[model samples]
Target: MADLDPTATFKEFDADGDGYITREEFTAAMKARGEEVTPAELDSIFRVADGRDGDADGRISQAEFLVAWDR
Candidate 1:
């Protein structure tokens, strides 16, 4: 399988062009991608992604996201 481009994925989720993916952005991105997630489930998903590598800043920085992708 071809590799997933973490930067591209991150860019897709960083809707605001602010170099960070907020919870709102993440939720919107997921919904736009046709992900069916309830509010609680979305929160959990964001929490896990934001929590990866111990980054709990409430927003996802590209660095954090890249590290989470192990790239």
Candidate 2:
């Protein structure tokens, strides 16, 4: 797959314009992209994203989202 633009993708997923992607926003984004993420998969994604969360907030920041996307 072609590399996605992190900034653009991040903005799109940040539905609330809060500069962070909550789990709900992430799930909605995934669904919009036709990705049916299972609960297990969502948990895994959150775990990975949280691991990279510098501020320890539950939501994923742009930097954290970019890191996960690059991976």
Candidate 3:
């Protein structure tokens, strides 16, 4: 996982190739990997990831994702 390129990985989750990753996109991406993630789990994750700025727009930008990934 650490070896994976962040930009490419982020793009994968972006799904629609949007500049940001929405909850739906993230969940879909996780499912594609055969991981079953619940809404609560996703909520917890976004809470932490988006908490970085205290203003989460319900979408994750590449820069925000990188910060979360490093942690």
Tens-place lDDT digits, model 2, residues 1-71:
13368888888889999999888998898888877778888778777777875455678888887777777
Taking all chains together, each candidate's TM-score versus the true structure is 0.68, 0.82, 0.87
Q: List the residue pairs that clash in candidate 2.
A: none
Residue pairs with backbone overlap in model 3: none
RMSD of 2: 2.0
lDDT of each: 0.77, 0.80, 0.84
**lDDT measured at residue 9 in model 1 versus the true structure, 0 to 100:** 90
Model 1: lowest-lDDT 10 consecutive positions: 45-54
Q: Which of candidates 1 and 3 reaches a greater TM-score?
A: 3
Instruction: State the local distance difference test value for candidate 3.
Output: 0.84
Tens-digit lDDT string for candidate 3 (1-71): 34378888899899998788899999898888888888898898888767876777778888889987888
1 against 3, candidate with superior lDDT: 3
Candidate maximizing lDDT: 3
Give the alpha carbon lDDT tens digit for every residue of 1-71 in model 1: 02388889988889878999887887788788877557787677568767774767777788877876773
Off by over 4 Å in 1: 1-3, 38-56
Best candidate (score: TM-score)? 3
